[model samples]
Target: MTEIRLITFDLDNTLWDVGEVLHHAEQQMRQWLDANVPEYTRTLDRDALTKIRTAVVTERPQLGHNVSALRQEVLFRGIVSCGYPATEARRYARSAFATFFQARQEVVFFEHALEALGELAASYQLGALTNGNADIQRVGLDRFFSFAFSSADVAASKPAPDIFHAALNHAGVAPQQCIHVGDNLIDDVHGAGSVGMHTIWVKLSDQPNTIGHTQPSEVVEDLAELPGAVSRIHTA
Candidate 1:
């Protein structure tokens, strides 16, 4: 068995509960809409905004461009379609959506998240690979990771091997020497495994049980369990 010298983490649901944070963001966006775009209050509800955003993103997959930029575009479209003046729509959209994006930065890390990161960082070269705009530097997790790569920066999202390969290259390690941990089954586990990197599925309650679905090197319920899992591979 190969010793694991590098441990890469997925940002959103791995280190923190992304669903909770996104719920808060959605709440904030709805409040902003209600306060600013009062005319379409009944029509442009939270569910409506979410549906429209999903459709727009699906239709314009190429515009997986920038999460923030895409988010802004979606909010602007929502507001304009609600009958707001174009100038007012742009203004409120920028102000309201910027607040929502900034709120994502306030996402709370799981208990022991930093401790687990620090522990892992001590022995192995640590890096991060995320699909979203999780600015590790801005989030103050930069110290824990030697290198951080995002789909936004790589121009390729997860389930694509390029993003994973980019992280491996950044860490100066081979695929076999590193392990990727993420919450998503397809993007984090299957994708990394496809590229010859060991993978750990960070199981979350919201996600269905993927135990028999895809083979990861391991499955951990929380980030705190990661260090031991990685150590076992190194020792074996």
Candidate 2:
């Protein structure tokens, strides 16, 4: 059996509950806007801002991968709509996005996430392949990865082959020699599988774990169970 040479990971939801983190980050941004630019607080409330973000991504599909730019653009647009001049809008957008970003990086990891990664990192070349803007360095997880590629890095997100291929080439490994661990069935499991890599699905819940009736190569309940699952897959 071929040994797994490189292991790539998904960030949000796989390592931490991203939904809660994002919600808190949004609240932080709202508070900042209320204190600094009070008009935006009234005009770009949560729901309104969500619609603006959706519209920005919808109109410029490529912005989906570049979350930082997408966010800045949304803030700029929102501020402009609320009667701010273009110059002040841009300035405020940069400052506001920075505030939200700091809060976003304050992630609370899942149980045993760091311990399991430490164990795996000893024997394998670890990498991160995420569609989010989460900075491994900021999150104190940079020590685990030899390389980390985000959608911003590759100009494309998961379920696409580009980011997967980037990680494979970075590690100088073939698809069969790599394994991708992620929580999403389609973007993580099927995405890596489509590129001919092995996959481990981090099934956090008992929800249906199939992509159009096709199951992942392996499934684990949490990061604590990941090391054993990877060991089994390496020799299978």
Candidate 3:
């Protein structure tokens, strides 16, 4: 295999606990809504809000909308469904949803992310490619990545070759010279492998060995193990 010179990462589940982040964000949204929209305080709870948001997203999948837009829409629609006027619904939606989405910047990184990123950035070109709008700048990980590409920016999500190719192009590296690390088997391992890039599966939880069914690659439980995994692949 060609010597690996570039390393691209998937942001959400790889370097951060997305579950924890989303959980906190949800709680924050609920508290904000309850305080501001007294009528909603009695009617809409977090679970109901979540279900309505899911329905909206499923119904409008082709809108290519971001989470922020969807959240606002869900809040407004939920208020209107509860017999609130359009003007009042829009007002509460803007205030409550902005508070929640902006607070997402407080999400914490994985324990090993800083040390691993520092070590690898010293030796190889580091980049990020994510299917979601995980603002690296807001997350304070922007300095570690040489380039960052998001599905929102590229109009193509993971499991698609276009997102990976965009990351390689931004990093000025060829497929054979880069290894893509992510938590999803199909999106990270299979997609990167399809383009001749090495793969690293960051097993955040006890995930099954799905990669075994596809092309063989390295696996690590945490970001700290990533440097060694890359070294082994290079020396193999």
Most accurate candidate by lDDT: 2
lDDT of 1 by residue, 101-205 (tens): 777777799877898899988988888888887678878998988788877787778889998889888777889998998888898898899999998888855
Best candidate (score: TM-score): 2
Which lDDT tens digits does candidate 2 get at residues 163-204?
Answer: 999998888999999989999988998899899999989988
lDDT to native, each model: 0.82, 0.91, 0.81
Model 1 ranges off by over 4 Å:
46-51, 85-88, 204-213
For model 3, the run of ten residues with the poorest summed lDDT? 62-71
Decide which is better by TM-score, 2 or 3. Answer: 2
Which portions of model 3 show Cα errors greater than 4 Å?
A: 45-51, 63-65
Against the hidden reference, what TM-scores do the models get? 0.86, 0.95, 0.86
Report the poorest 10 consecutive residues by lDDT, candidate 1.
Answer: 204-213
Error of 3 at 199 (Å): 0.7
